[model samples]
Target chain A: SAVISQKPSRDICQRGTSLTIQCQVDSQVTMMFWYRQQPGQSLTLIATANQGSEATYESGFVIDKFPISRPNLTFSTLTVSNMSPEDSSIYLCSVDNGAFFGQGTRLTVV
Target chain B: DQQVKQNSPSLSVQEGRISILNCDYTNSMFDYFLWYKKYPAEGPTFLISISSIKDKNEDGRFTVFLNKSAKHLSLHIVPSQPGDSAVYFCAAIGSNYKLTFGKGTLLTVNP
Candidate 1:
């Protein structure tokens, strides 16, 4: 098991603005992932944050909209750019050792 | 289309009874499956996992059974306790080491 922490556990953001959520893990993990879960919906993969390289965005997501940064093995950040009401959801970061998730950041667009 | 499905939105069971949560997957490439339990204001916790190579795996009160032919798997918590109540999520591991998670089922264990 891994201990993960996220910044700004819950946030109310104005539309058209961007928000960046940070994820820190207790130990270095090889693979880190980002996921989004809308209200009452299943989790969807956003991207795989790679250390020293570009993140791999999933089918419905693109780097321009959700740019990711992984400076090292233990930390990553996800920025949701130009947000809208439809982007209101819970964004989570996970370390894949098997798999473990961070306490999600709940984002609401107003 | 959803590759992993937990059709039951919620379930209720009495304490000391067995709580069974079911999941089905549409992808045959899934070689590993896992169950996670989540409480409000917290991240999902790892519960149990089963490989497609095996049929059943048990640890203490929690057991996971896999039926590869049916693309189905189930988690069984025997003698369910009130503390065991939470949202259970089922996930399948695909070729890229990516996981596909189900919608999750809220389980309530009543005393």
Candidate 2:
């Protein structure tokens, strides 16, 4: 089991503003995944962040909107750029191939 | 297309009774099935997982049963407690190693 620490447990941002969420893992991992859960929806994969390389985003997401940074195996950050009311959701980071997850960052755009 | 599916949006059960949550998948390439529990304003927590090779996996109060032919799985919790009330998510990992999750089931274990 892996332990992950995510920052900014909850945040309210103005539309068009940006918020960066950080994730720290207890151990080094080759891959870190970012996910989003919108209201009344299932969790959706946003991107896969690997150290020293570009993140691979899923079909419905893009880097310009949700940029990711994996500085090292133990740390990664996700930035929600130019937020909108529709972007209000819970963002989470996970390691150990989805076996463990951080407490998640809840973003509310208004 | 929704690869994974949880038909029941919510379930209500009495405390100390058994709680069963069901899940199904359309993709046969999934290598592992997992269950996660989440509370309001919190991230989903990994509760248990079962490999595709096995039919059953048990850990303390939780048990997961898989049926490969049907592409279905279920999580059983014995002596359900009020504390267990939460949204339960069913997720599957395919060859890509990324998880495809189902729309969670809200379980309410009333006292």
- For model 1, the stretches where C-alpha displacement exceeds 4 angstroms are none
Candidate 2 lDDT, B7-99, residue by residue in tens: 999999999999999999999999899999999867789999999999999999999999999999999999899999999999999998889
Candidate 2 chain A minimal-lDDT segment of 10 residues: A94-103
Collision pairs in model 2: none
Model 1 lDDT per residue over B1-111, tens place: 999999999999999999999999999999999999999878788899999999999999999999999999999999899999999999999788888899999999999
Interface RMSD of 2: 1.0
Q: Runs in model 2 with CA error above 4 Å?
A: none
Candidate 2 TM-score versus the reference:
0.95
**Number of the predicted model whose lDDT against the real structure is largest:** 2
Docking quality level of the chain pair in candidate 1 = medium
- Cα lDDT tens digits for candidate 1, A3-57: 8999979999999999999999999987799999999988899999889999999
